[model samples]
Target: MGIDPKTIDWDSLGFNLIETRSMYKATCKKDDSWSPGELIPFGNIELSPAAGVLNYGQGVFEGMKAYRTLKNRIVLFRPEMNAKRISMSTKRLCIPEMDEELFLKAAIEIVKDNVDYIPPYGKGSLYLRPVVWGTGPVLGVKPADEYTFIIFASPVGPYFKGNIKPLHLKVTHNFHRAAPKGIGNAKAIGNYSASLYPSSLAKKTGFDEVIYLNAGNEQLIEEVGSANMFIVKDNVLKTPRLAGSILPGVTRDSVLTLAKEKLDIEVQETDVLLDEVCSADEVFCTGTAVVVTPVGKITSEDGEHSINDGKIGIITHELRSLLLGIQREECEDTLNWLHPID
Candidate 1:
């Protein structure tokens, strides 16, 4: 199952699926115990038409990456966090929890089997997606009697095209991504489905993405289409607090930690008003896919407002560099975030 590097145009890789040599698959039986995962050929999976995941949306997934380090070592960044989040999401969705050790093992083994697909050190990294879904057919509105967990890898470049320039965002009051007290906190597949319409509208109107406000107030900023939003003003870093409506992103947490420990910057988590955000010094969003992306302008009903004079801010630049450095093993991982794949 060896992959030929020459077959891939690594430099032109996008955030699209390019299946690797193998993937990890584990199944949870009716007795609530998981089977030992094994590497299987990367391909389609058979499922029942009435599967709980197909009918009732009983699914949860985690996004992570395996990096090729400067010393030619493979590593994962803060995979434990992804495992914890996946467990929490499964609990909320009524699916069986995956063993953290087994989850980690699957991630490592899948990456090992697909090591040849790992993009060269500078081009990009291997994107790992771990998904758990109910496979048992259920006619009623109840949890499934069986489930399956799979981990797969794909080589991807930056999520957003172009250089590390600033991106434009559109704040929409016409749509809400999640409710105040709903499954928004979980990495559920349905949440993204709800966002497709608004996001498509925003993109069609010549904007990068859409910013969703709280469903309750529709004033307080919740998050972007697929990432967590942060605003910098008066030398303090502020982001929307996780009040059960926004997904607590891993990169968002990492940026907050780096701002406090490495840069000694003041960090705050609270409600971010649209009015205040329009006047902020800088704006950015974070996610596993994009990592950190600076916002250049926000288009609202009132008008378009430019952030940091329509350019990337110093804080955003430095933080992105710091995070990327740690990920690529170009800088010291003082927090011991990198878990080497052995």
Candidate 2:
């Protein structure tokens, strides 16, 4: 009549696990020595009402995944990269610098402990979220002295719920996601919270996602809400270079490497004008969750334009399959990007 994830057969792309448990947590003290991190049950967190994160929006986070490889082993895709990015976010938010090795250790432990939740070959994956935030009471406007770092795991399928249709996007020139010297690069909660309203408005208007451009000039593309953008034209891959404005996405980096070495394509990191992208043969977005998603059409106040026959282009699909092959352990990981969990 009913079944649990563990009860299902571990066939290709299926999620079947007997039991799920354990999480990693650590508390940061003002003394700079973090309390010994521990493995605990998956549960709720207790935070102070007046914490800096609540009042002043002082928090940051990162997203990663554990894949079920062909060898039936669990591996994380460049987790150290995510940890390093979190460190950068902390510095930007005035948070304490955490030991990267220790953080990686905790992350690995959490995924290994909850390995059963990892979906079968093509099913899905175990999504890991590492969150760091101000904790304890802090009524002042400055950063909080106390903090908490926690890692949690969940079995997730596709990022978008419905059919795997290429997204229809809207280029927004009015609202901007991040500012020149602001906290846009960081994976801070407030940055996403700020995007909710505008994104919701776009959805109501029939646009799948809103492509937020720079505030000053509507030329440079920053990022989608949860992913970064890329353009493929004449066998050349172009993405917005890391200005202080865009979030440095790990998947974006991976795709660039794959395009150059494996696919024998030229990749460029430069500022691309919105008009220039209109001429591109293909466009796609990349992130840890949505590995590579194509953009079929874009509508702006200026008017709508079709991107490469308004279909998922050949280059986008090829790159996505190659990357997913490595992630799912279906293909050779030549770059040694996957780290196996104990």
Candidate 3:
């Protein structure tokens, strides 16, 4: 057993760890297949001091959420997309790839075991973090002999504290979120480490997050530090094309589909220039954590640009409402994105 639900202040939940009942785990060797994992009680596990993850940073993780819906039911949104993405990350990191079926099964089992930790409907959702790490010792810069896969969770609130109010972001050409020919698209642990300093600096200066430009071309916008970015220009919804450097967010894909089908908006996936984003009619971001949030202000060397007069754009509001409605079972899940836990 873990912390009692009665003690959890659901209304005050944030994106911090609230230890749950158990976590799923599996192991494998470099040349072997992944073992059938089991749910282990939440606690620390021993690891080698010279582990590859500790030394060379060989790890990949995926972020997804489980929601308690309006029908008093538990569900996941587009989990298969997460499964596939994790698989890609593992392969890129040299970790023995785990089967997607096993991944989904393990995810289900972990959530069910920690069901009580899930916040109540409309309060917040349980944040799921599935990670694969190179656990074996490594001396030279090479793949480890063994690996570990774990799926843990926490009860959390909105990623950005201000709620639906638009975000104030800083554009930084000084740092790039990913390399065009590197592990930027793999969700590798190191990719995030590269952004900590810049992101923290931006936050200290009163900005919510920093937007990175493409490594090869500073003229092109890549993505927000931890989320995908989008711009609305002249009624066209546009986002940076996935050119192997940017993360292909599940929420990003869902938003694109919804814009075209539900809202009848033309969508464009291609090169998005820095000038284009700073001058767009509206800007927003999407991820498991942020869901959908508009960019109200963008601060760069040139100056501060206010989007839609520093308010959440109309299109941004509609998209967020439609997506949340489906997540909460309030509207028709026309896309069949939600997978009921039961």
Candidate 4:
């Protein structure tokens, strides 16, 4: 009965203070070779005042999780996806490329070292964070000459607390998350920083989240601030196409794959029109943090439109269950998406 995982209330669980005493860290020089990766204490390290990340906002990070399955195995859902996305992020900011093999190894080792803190199958998960930052000290307006990669883990509960209900969204027309041919496609720190004000405004107006459509043209739905948007109509799953603006989420890809193979749903990845979304049967958002969120109602310039039953829809619930099954190691992993750590 010592901290029973199943009995632990995920909504009220906070970070436990037990130190893992281990972190995976490595440094890359100008020549692109990585220094020896080491497992060190989870403590702060000093950086130069003129660090490129401090001044130029040259930092990128990825959020992933490890779940203890019903089979008593620790598994990570689609970590390779995180590796690929972080590589793309490096390219976007002119940072040195990371060896995918090395990066993945570091991530896995960090989780393995802290496996005891990984909550039970359904209670919560061990949230994995892989961060890359420009480390060189430079006052000039150019790319940093060096960089550091670090991987850390912490136990986390469900991203959205309370019952898993459909969310309320406000269409943000006055702001844009990313411009065409801009850094919006990358998971950079600056992109999220720029969106804080608009997101705050949306929350103040009684909305659960904000969906930003393309600037000037309200017809094309780009994406939400932190997740990918999806609309269901007539048994079809539609999401915004990658038009050089949206972050391609790993959870979104997993849902599409599961829908096609398990649910037998027609998955469409294309340009979703804002007007068409108003008439969608149901809407949902996907991300690493929030596995899946049902959109209850959408508030736009015209008015609010109620989604399917103003609650979690049938298809949305089905998809969420299927995906969670795979993550929790309850279902047979037909797609081989889960990588077990022990």
What RMSD, rounded to one decimal, does every model reach?
A: 1.4, 3.2, 1.1, 3.1
TM-score to true structure, per model: 0.97, 0.93, 0.98, 0.94
Clash-forming residue pairs, model 2: 5-16, 5-17, 6-17, 6-18, 13-121, 13-122, 13-123
Candidate 1: which pairs clash?
A: none
Cα lDDT for residue 46, model 3? 91
**Residue-by-residue lDDT tens digits, candidate 3, 157-268:** 8665555778899999788888888998888999999999999999999999999999999999989879999999999999999999998899999999999999999999
lDDT of 4: 0.84
Report RMSD for candidate 3.
1.1
Q: For residue 238, give model 3's deviation from the true position in Å.
A: 0.3
lDDT of 1 by residue, 1-342 (tens): 435656999889988888788888999965586667788888889999999999999999999999898877899999999988998898889888777878888888988888889988877889999999999999999999999999988999866656877889999878999998899999999998999999999999999999898888877999989899999999899999999989989999999999999999999999899998899999999998888999999999899999999998999999999998999899999999999987
131, model 1: CA deviation in Å?
A: 0.6
**Which candidate model has the greater lDDT, 3 or 4?**
3
* Candidate with the larger TM-score of 1 and 2: 1
State model 3's lDDT. Answer: 0.91
Q: Candidate 1: which stretches are off by over 4 Å?
A: 1-5, 160-162
Error of 3 at 299 (Å): 1.1
Put down candidate 2 lDDT per residue, 54-134, tens digits, no spaces: 888888999888888788888899988998988889778877766788889988888877776777766677878888888
